[model samples]
Target: MAVVSACIVALSGCALPRSGPKDDEILAGSKAEGGPVNVVLVDNRVAVASYLDDNLSFPSSFTGAGLASTDTINPGDVISVTVWENVDPALLVGPGQKQAFIQEIQVDQAGNIFMPYAGVLKAAGNTPEQLRRLITRKLDPQTPDPQVEVRRVAGDGSSISVIGGVGAQGVYPLVPSTTRLSAMLATAGGVTIDPDVAQVAVRRGGTTGRIFLQDLYDDPRLDVALRANDKIIVEEDRRTFTALGATSTQARVPFPQGRMSVVEAVAEVGGLNGNTSDPTGIFVFRREVQSIANKVTGRNDLGENEPFVYVIDLTRPDGVFLAKEFQVRDKDTIYITEAPFVAWTKILTATSQTLSFTADVVRVGDLLTDN
Candidate 1:
């Protein structure tokens, strides 16, 4: 009997109440503390729905200045010049020379292109049409009514660059016809990672902006026109959160590039452990900037912008709707406390096993004595 009592005492001690405060108690403590980090009880329907509707949005379009549409002649560009003199061909060239003169020239580093009668002419910084007019003006003295046409055969100076997380990385030339962002990405063989979770970054001039790939697809206006020398990058999404406590799995889980709700986050972690999880104790721990915290809780005295604990009571049937509306942010901690009964169940099971073993020992001793 003494042995049984000892076992019972040990089991009872193991069954002592959990150490942490209850869900409601935690909220009350936060209210009393008046600290920067506030504990918000998400027990209502209106607040959850309003937050979800207000805070979820795709990032705005990049408004930074980009390359201009005008294509100027640059060094290393192949320029083809053709001159036509209908009447006095001999004045431009030798006697009995053909009426038309065609020359293929490359713009030199000094921004100049040489012609037979026009001498060395500045081609760089001038459009093809502008250069043709200049060439015709220069040849007016040597030939009678000379007509000149200037064409650029190969010039890669006005091209956009596609690199990083793409199937192919290279400089893609931009034509006036196909200058949209989607065209440039398709030319580079598209992104290597999952498009749903990838982010597209556009760098132009000294400014850079990013948008999720899904946003570009959802809104056609987001596929803005591309410019020369712009850089487009696609990379894997970095938004993630950690799951802990009585969740089915405890691990870091990445969310889709777009908005993710608490319901989606829970499902990603394999949902709560049905037997151990306390339906009333679902919590999300998050830290926000001072301004954000103040705006969120409507409290002015938030100390150094500490973390906030947002609790959702899953025991209520309306919790499912609230969970669907509660957005989960990056680096958040999703925790589900164990049920109160779980500890008592463990203690009782251990006590029962100990009693059964003790009874067997006594029975064996009795059999030995009878023998």
Candidate 2:
């Protein structure tokens, strides 16, 4: 009995199976002690405020332009010019005909369009009305009271391309009604993915900007005015976080909505395991941005993408509320450690099973001897 007890004690000293490191072990390995990660205690309002300030939003200059209007002519645009003269024989019209139609007149690269008798005229940067007066003046010397009408036609100069995760993917003309970003998206059949998880990216010239699709709806300023030749892409959010350790489920969970808090993320993974999780040992592992790390750690020695582990103790008075306020970013890892007693429980259960098996063997030997 003494030998068996000694063996059981020796086995208990060995490492037991655990889902992850305990709260104390995580603290010991933090960057304060020259460890791999920086440990942050998110127990006060200041800590929560630091993370809340880091949000995803579009640049202020992105929305500076208001709604777009497709009235002025541009290079590569096609316009039709009609000339009407009351004279029996006009310079622009036929000898017997009173009117003549110059169809499919496209604006050249230099913003100029040529007519038969009016010579080369500037069309780009001028409205249809402005171009009409110019053409009438150019032909007034050759034909008296010559009337000219300039009408813009379908062309590639004033159009945008909408693609990726939309109901329709094509180049849509920017008309008077569908010139804004949201209106153009609607013209392309809106977005096919859920608005909460959709991302909108706009590329114009050499600059580009991105924002959440929901942000475009919640804030009117985010819906900037569209421009000609702008390329818009709508796609699903690819950001994800890994849930491990004693949680009810361990997997890579996709963000269901924008601006997800720590509490919401834990709920997404089925919360912590009631049988084994330590409420005080919930940890979020991530790489903090350099600027944010400097503010959070109160030091400026950190390099870019500093390794960070944010600790949350739900057992504390303000732990749950703090977790509710703290935001979780992309590629973060949430780990919940098992309770300390759970290890002792497993050891005791194993010891008891070993003793029970030994007793059963002794009882069988005694019965065999009696037989």
lDDT of each: 0.75, 0.86
Instruction: Write the residue-wise lDDT of candidate 2 on 53-115 in tens digits.
Output: 544565656688776668789888999989899898777666899899999999998999998
Candidate 2, residue 345: Cα displacement in angstroms equals 3.6
* Residue 350's lDDT in candidate 1: 83
Return the TM-score for candidate 1, rounded to 2 decimals. 0.80
User: What's the lDDT for candidate 2?
Assistant: 0.86
Using alpha carbons, what is the TM-score of model 2?
0.89
Q: Pick the candidate with the highest TM-score.
A: 2
Top candidate on lDDT is: 2
